[model samples]
Structure formats: structure tokens, C-alpha cells
Target chain A: MAETTRASDPGTGTATPDAHTAPLSEFDRDTAVRRRARGEFETVIADGWSVFGAVNGGYLKAMVGRAVAETLPHPHPATVTAHYLTAPRPGPAVIRVETVREGRTLSTATASLTQTDPDGTEVERLRVLATHTDLTAGPDEVRTTAEMPDIPAYEDCVGMDLAPPEFLRDAPIVHRLAGRLDPDCVGWAVGVPSGRAGTRGWFAFADGRPVDPLALLMVGDALPPSVFDLGLSGWVPTIELTTHVRALPAPGPLRVALTTRNLAGGLLEEDGEVWDSAGRLVAQSRQLARAPRG
Target chain B: MAETTRASDPGTGTATPDAHTAPLSEFDRDTAVRRRARGEFETVIADGWSVFGAVNGGYLKAMVGRAVAETLPHPHPATVTAHYLTAPRPGPAVIRVETVREGRTLSTATASLTQTDPDGTEVERLRVLATHTDLTAGPDEVRTTAEMPDIPAYEDCVGMDLAPPEFLRDAPIVHRLAGRLDPDCVGWAVGVPSGRAGTRGWFAFADGRPVDPLALLMVGDALPPSVFDLGLSGWVPTIELTTHVRALPAPGPLRVALTTRNLAGGLLEEDGEVWDSAGRLVAQSRQLARAPRG
Candidate 1:
């Protein structure tokens, strides 16, 4: 529930709250609550049902990263394999974490999310595998074929007036974290901040919204055509999505580079990396999606 | 490879020399491996690929499982998610287990398998997420939708007219683990005796050749049509496979029950569960596949 205070206390139409704010920044609000708890783990069940509306992809991705941060060991980073069970509607849900085993160097926990229904069945389950390390030499021969595209910056590219539907007006989480998108700005995400080894990167929405990792993962499969120089209108729907998050960035700009290794008649596979401003590879995503018709 | 003794040699065709010397009963093989490794942890890669086969799913699954097991603390059960990056061929591979973090009750480990290639471009990366556990309580409404199906015994199911494939006959590793399958067998599996908590059932080819889990995963999805009375002519190819191994079952006489949910507009989704004769749930698998016209 949200407070009913807006600029339009009376009748000025111009002072009215934005329609998209009906469920404005619930995750941000929730985090504000959790921050007060000294960063201990918390759970809020998703109780209502509605389309995610205009939340940007990157913001959703950040949500997932936040989820991982909430459950993983503090200070030590984690690599998580997340599978989207279904699109969640804005509501409340409870997340439970059970520490499986704890060792000197490594630990494991299982997080299960059960959606509250009158019938009471678990709708989704997430298993995260995290490793703790002080520091070590990483993998060698790290090569990626994704070349950064020449897109405009956030400031110069705004106000091109390419808007979508009402429900989707500025709701995507990606745009919020990366920064306001200028029309000239291509949907490129860089890795996370500096001093981070392994992978870290920045990601934002083409249309601005808050950045959430879950959204990026939800739409990471949508990059084959864009990565392969094909139009988004031509690709098939994604059947499965699998993302590997090595580490989180220090919070900054995001650049995404996509490359296609195999694309046949109807089936296609693409790999993408999310980079932050500091050029650390924050996250990597791979998916098997259907290639839409040209 | 196996030593070829003459059929006329006493106790040759019936069982192997070890079996002749210490006559392994059906239960002996079932419980032998399980008893040997309980409470204590074994360094699977310490022996370094001594017992393995090229391209078999069972060998791959077990090898991967053992890799994860080595990283776990003594006597902790492990549940692993092995993602197949590429098809493994015959050869030597190394399984490295690193402790992530150890705690009082639970612990975790990161296990990876790297196959050395002659070309050496990209070594096939098999990553396993493993964990160990202690006491846990779960008296909730425990129910599984994976219903058992009616099938003939493993011996009755094998046709006398159909000679088993040469690969099934010749592989030493396969011959050692052949009792794992029965005619009334629920599904194709390859597994060695765990000699610990329970049996570990897996998928294997008839030719004593170890089958890949992906291939067995395909069967898990395909059989639902037959099990659910869809009356389809041929097996359907899987479009998506999602599997979760809740617990390990012993290596022999595993039962699998597949239920088809729908076959509409060329797409199908099947739900399945594998159980032992003791009526315990060992594994759960679900698949989304395209039903081709038989």
C-alpha cells in the first residue's frame, strides 16, 4: 500500500501523479525498509496480479541481483543461475532462505519463493550457488566477440518522442539504474564498477525506469536479433532463459554487447555480457531462443 | 575395454571374475557401492578417471556428481545441477572441488570438469553446484504429481529376438553396472552403487555405452505421451528440458512415471518423477516439447 499524497492535492490536472506511479517503485520502497534493518535478509511476497507494465529491463535485472545480494554471504560475491518460472505481478510474497551447509571457504543456501494463494501452492523456486573467496587468479584466455556499438550518450539522446503504451510508460527497471536514456542512446550496457574481478557491468532500459537485475534476465533472451544486427521485430519468442551473474557493480552506467554464434532456420542462440562503466564484466547471459521471421 | 574370456570358461557368461570369486547377489551389487562410501568422503578425481566411458550420460552424471562430492564435507549429501556445455567424448578429464564456505550446519562447494582437447581451443566446461546437509524437518503437505506407470520387468522387456547392440555388450564400465537396469525398468538409466545414503539412478545407452543426461532428458519428456494415454505414434523431440534432482536413489530398479499435461497446437509439456521401489521420490523432471505427428 502507498500513501495518497501527490502534487495534485486538489484539481489541477497538470499536478496529477503519473499514472505509472500507481505501483511506483515498490522495490525501492521495500529496500528503504530493509536498509533500516541493518541489511539483514527480508522477504515481501508478491500478492497482486498485473502485468509488469513499463518497468525497464535493466531495473528488473537489478532486482534479481538484489535478491542474490540479500541471500548470499556479505562481502563475498556469488554466481547464480536463475530461471524465470513465470512473470510476476506486483504484489507481496515471502522468500525463505535455508543455509544448507557452511564450511570454512564455501557455503550454500536454498531460497524458495512461495506465492500466497488461497489454495497455497508454490509458484516459483530459486536455487543460488555462491562461492566465497578472498582473492585468486581468474580464468585466462577470456575472449568475447561482442564489439560495443556506436550509440549516443544518455544526455544527447533524450526526447525523440518514441513512446509506448500507458501501462508501460517508464516502468521498466533497467532505465532507472543505468540513467535516463537519450533517443540517440543505443540499448548498450557496460559492466559494473572498478576493483571488481570476474564479471561486472552496467545495464539500463532503452526507455528509462529503475534498474533491476530480474528485468534484464527476463529480457536477456530478447537480444539475438539486436546482437546479430537483425531487427527486434524479426525474432521468435524465447523458450528458456539462463543467466550467470558473477558479481554486482558499484552502481553506474551499463553497456551491453551481444553476439550470435549459431542461428539456423528457426532456432538461434546468442550470448550477451553486461558491463559497467569501469569495464568490468558484471554478468553474462546465454539463451536458446526462436528466431522470428524476417 | 574389457578382458574377453571364452564362453566355455567356467562362470564366464554368468558374471565377471570378481562376481565368480565373491558371487555378487542382486542386492550385493545394489548395496555394495552404497555401503563402501557412507559417512566418509572419497576424492573422485584422486583416482583420476580410472572408471569412465566416452560419451555416456551415466558416466558423465556420476563423474560430475563425484566431482561435486569431493568438494563436500564428510557425510554431507549433495544435490548438483550439471549444465552440459558440450557433448563429452572419450578421454581423461579432471574434477576440481573447491570449498566455498563452511559453517556449523551447512556447506557448499564449486566443482568443475575440464576436458583436455587436442585442438585446445575451448575446453568443455562442466560446472556443478553441490552442497552438503545435516538434519532438516519437512512435515508439510508433501505430495508429488509424478504418478507411476505400468510396465513389464527389465528382463521381460528385453526381447530375445533383438540382440543387444555390440556397444552394450563390450563396454567394461557398462558391463560392471548392467544390473542397474531392469526390463520393467522405468526409464533408461546408468548408475554405480552409491554405497552410502541411497542409489544414484542415471541414463545410459544399451551398448554398455554411457548415455548423456541430455539424451536421457529427452526420453523423460518424450515418454509422457505414451504414459498419459496420448496414443501418439512416435517419440516427440524435446524443445525445453528442466530437471531437478531432489534426492539420490540407489542404482537399480528405478521407477519413472511421466504424465502428459497437454498436446495442443504442436506444443506439449510433460511432468515426470523418478522413484525407487520403496516409493520414495528420488528425482523430478519436467519438459516442454513439440509433438510431431506420428
Candidate 2:
């Protein structure tokens, strides 16, 4: 099964090596891979998580997510909002956490990710505000309400086409985007504007690691801006993004729905939902980004 | 106009005192109403903003928004996320900011709002991660794309009925809710479940203060959880909410569109778009809140 999903690495332009051959346990092992001492959490971003030049925001989020989650009694991160301060290069980073109110039902905490400068000043990297809670025990109001949209199976969606930017093309992950009748990224990928908005797709690591909560964040925003389909172009940068982890996804290619409801006042808002293959909604994210210029 | 709008104070239930007597500029006056010393941004959350017990989240947000925006070269609070740590009784609060990265075009900063107890130990109150940018100079891709759903004019919409909760009712704000042939939070008011899920309204302060960007934040989340209409009942506490200030809202009763896209595993996500009376998309917000339970 992995063989069929196997393909050359577009970002590296290399015969996609079985670099994904690492065990699936690495998802948990790598994301929580941190050490704490003297009021700070520190971690080395292991290999294979870069999108283009910087580390994937989702993976970075997982690092802080775990660090902060550990500070609270709740085992599940109900809400986590990470503010990218300075995107640090994949490397040794420091996370300092402040516990706000450690309630029995819910715990709210904040973490700051930083790296030391050569001059020894702690360079701040990211600020994360998270609420951790025991999902099953939360106020006892559980229901699966929004039915998953009837999206075609992973095999039905198109494999990533004309790669996003040169940077995102080389990621060490695999993606299966939804097939769209409209043109994709023509303004940037091609020379003309496709003049539509929205991009949907499924994603999994090349090595077949099932997506955990952290990876879902990465995969959720990792898609090309839906605006690209609209024929608008440029780097559509994420100004602020908030993700709600609905449930730890069940294994397999994660199916996702992505769209921009409005492109106004020089900004576009992307609304994305991630559904596990089991058809359960796993996570939902909304990001505010600048619309790419024509 | 003030006499006409200044009819009742729902949340306070006071004989609508001269309290609503202050000009709407007081919202701005009370929010940015700050003092900075020793690298701390401080302000008093004046009276009149709380819905029931604590200050409204949107009002709290504007306080931080103004303080942080004042610290940045860009005066606009482009993106701001506030995680309620522990609700502080309206009083003096201190905001300590950490400059994330002050780019020429955009500046990212994080602030921790704290209030000192009688013991003198500062209690961490709220965490706000904000991006400040010059709204007018923002990428310049200005284009109004999404059309506001045509609805009755402000006067045509019924004045708020079936007040949201005992807490939101009797507040100084006056709400002109869009009358729904479908059931509303009236169930909560009448001790019955409405068995539907949706709420839309027009709102402005009782003193005739037009909604500003800061006030818009409050009004955006002010409506009863569309969930109440769904028959689920309990406090739908906001876990985390992110709002984009697409453009400074024009003065008038802001039209807000609110709905939860999905309610899975005890969590529901509310997507809200706030359009000015002029029908321009001024802001959009998505929040993760607990599903209301009976």
C-alpha cells in the first residue's frame, strides 16, 4: 500500500527516498520530544518537518502543545492558539510556560517559544495560548452534529498538482488534494489567473504515519490558498490562525475541506475542516491571511 | 437619539441611570485609558462593559487591543486572540508586552494582562497575541467580495426579545435582533428548548454610540449562541476565538452572521461575520466553544 502512495519528492527533486520509512511512533515521539528544566521547555526540531525553509507551523505547534498540555492536568488540548512571533529555523528552541488558572474541568496556560541569540539574548519565537481539558469529562455535552460533507475518497481526489511555491513543494509529507474542475494556482503556478477560490485535499506523511492532533494542524493549513484557484497570486501569508482539535483523528489519509468565504479589504479568511477517514470531524481551523496580489 | 436609545440597561437592571449617559467615546476612553511604566501597559476596565459577572470578552479584547496597538508603529490591531485565564473583576489591570518581531510592514506582539491581588502578587488574567499593521497600507488588495445576506433594516428587525440569558439581558447595550420565524433563544427564556440553531441581530449601545472596531468585537460575539436555538442548553463558554479586523467598521448597528459549522465530540465551532450598516465586511471571527448541555 505504501508503495502505491510512494512518489518522488518534489521539494527535493530527489527520487523520493523512503525517508518516511521511520516508524509511525515517531509522530508522537517527535512532537513531544522536549525537555524541561529551570522554568523552561526546550526541544530540537528533529529532521523532516520543514515546508520550504521554516519548520511547519503545525509541527511547531505540537511542540508547544505538548509542553503546555503537560503543565495542565487535562490530557487533551481542547483549544490552542499559537502566534508566530519570529519563525525560528528548525533548531534548538526554548518554551517558557505560564499556568493561568488550573481548574478541575479545564486548564488554561500560555507558552513562549524562543531560541538564544549568539549574543545570549533570548530571541522570542512564538506565543501560544491553550486550554487543555479531558474531552470525555468536559461538561458532559457530547454530540456529533455537523455531518461530514460527502467528499470523495482519497483515491478519488487528485494528487498534489503543479506544486505550490518552490519552498512548499519540497516538504517531507504526502498530499492528495481534492479534484477541482476549476483551474488551480494558475496565476502563480501558470501565468494566468484561474479566477476561482478554494482548495481541498487529503494528506498523510509519505511513510504512512497516521495523523495525530499535532500533524492535523500542519496538514490543515498546509494546503495552497483556496484563493489561488481564483487566479489571485502572491504569497498569501497567514496573519493569525486558530485551530480547534475536535478529536484525535483515526488513522489513514486525512480528508480536508478548505475554502475562503470572503476576500475583502485586502484580506481573505480561510475556513478549513479536517475529517478523518472514518468520516468524523477531527479538527476545524480558520485563518486570516492577506490576499495574494494580482 | 440618546433619549430614544437609552431606554433600559438589561444586565445591570438599574433604572438606566446616567451611566449610559457617557458618550460612546468613553468605550475608547475607558479602553486605551492606560498608563505605561517599567515596560507595563496598564488600564482600568471601567464599568458598563460586563454582560453578567465579568467584563465582556470583546471589551476585554479592545482594552488589550488598544494598549498593544499603541505600542506598535502600526496603530491597527489587525489580529488579536485573547484566552480568558481567570476573569478579573472590572478594575485595574496591567499588560506586559513582549515584542515578537517588529517588521517594517507588520509587527507581531504578545501581552499578558495581570491584576494584583490584595496580597500584591500579580495574578495573570488574559493572554493576547496580536498583530499590528497600518490598516490603510495593508497589502492593498482591497476588494469587497462576499455579499451580506439581505435582511430587514435595523428598525425593521425586532428589538432584542427573549434576551440571551439572564446575564446578557439588562446590559447597557441595546440589541435589535432580526426577528426569526424560526424559534430563537426564547426557549431559554420560556423554560423550553427551541429545537433550532440560529440567531442574527443588529446592535448598538443604548447611548447611541455607533459601533467602532473595538465595540464591534463585543457585538460580534454578543448574540445568543445559535446553539440555543438548536435545543442544547447550558453555558456555551468560548474556549478560544480569533477575529480579523478586515476594516474598521462603519458606524451603525452592525449586522452579524453567526452559526456553528460543526458540533462534534462536545465541542462546537461558531463562525461569525460582522458587516457594517453600509454592508461592508468589517470583521470575521471563529470561536471554539463547549456544546451547551441541559
* Per-residue lDDT of candidate 1, residues B1-294 (tens digit): 222321112111222226556544321222121112322222222221112232433334455554444445533332334443444555456555656545453455545556667887545444554444431321222223334445445444432113246534433333333233223332222223211111122222222222222223322432213321333433454332344433333334445555553343344445455654445554444443445464
Each model's TM-score for chain A is: 0.54, 0.77
Model 1 C-alpha lDDT per residue in residues A1-294, reported as the tens digit of each score: 212331111111122136476444444443321322332234452322112342222223334445545555543332334322333444544444444334443334434333455587545423343332211222322222223434455344332123244432433332223223323223322221121111112234332333334344433432223422332333243323345433343244455655543333233444456655444454555543445554
Give one digit per residue, the lDDT tens place, for model 2 in B47-160. 666545545667777777777766777777667787777667778888887777898877887777888998998887777788877777755354445778555665555555
Considering only chain B, what TM-score does candidate 2 achieve? 0.79
Please give the lDDT score at residue A260 for candidate 1: 49
Compare the candidates by TM-score and give the number of the best one. Answer: 2
